[model samples]
Target: MALNENEVLAGLAEIVAEETGIEADQVQMDKSFTDALDIDSLSMMTIVTLAEEKFDVRIPDEDVKDLLTVGDAVKYITKAQA
Candidate 1:
């Protein structure tokens, strides 16, 4: 099954919540992944792994680094799936 942007956003939010111990609703799309979600590089790597597993796609390291916000992650996932 292909993942849409909304699905990616929701899935990413779930992963972020799980990894950071934060509520899913607390992660806004516009918020910074580090500043708002308190996600460090390791957490981001976990998130990338989760996303790749969920979507069955590999997100490149260069692309992963650019995903600094919820929207960016969603967009990256959508593009990767495309």
Candidate 2:
């Protein structure tokens, strides 16, 4: 099955919110995960793992650099599904 961007955004928001202790409603697409969520590389790796498990998409460590914002993740996940 293909991944849904809306679903990805919602799930990613929940994941980030849970991991960062932030309100999910406050997670915007343009927000920088590092600056906004204050997540480190380890946390990012955890997020990547969670995304892989949830969306069944492969997010290489090298690709993690491209996922600076929530929108980038959404785009990558959707593209990976295709």
Cα-based lDDT at residue 58, candidate 1: 90
| Off by more than 4 A, model 2 | none
What TM-score against the true fold does each predicted structure earn? 0.89, 0.89
1-82: candidate 1 lDDT, tens digit per residue: 6777778778887888888898998877798988877788998898889889987789888888788888988887788788
TM-score of 1: 0.89
Residue 67, candidate 2: Cα error in Å is 0.7
- Top of the candidates by lDDT: 2
Candidate 2: lDDT of 45? 87
* Model 2 C-alpha lDDT versus the unseen true structure: 0.85
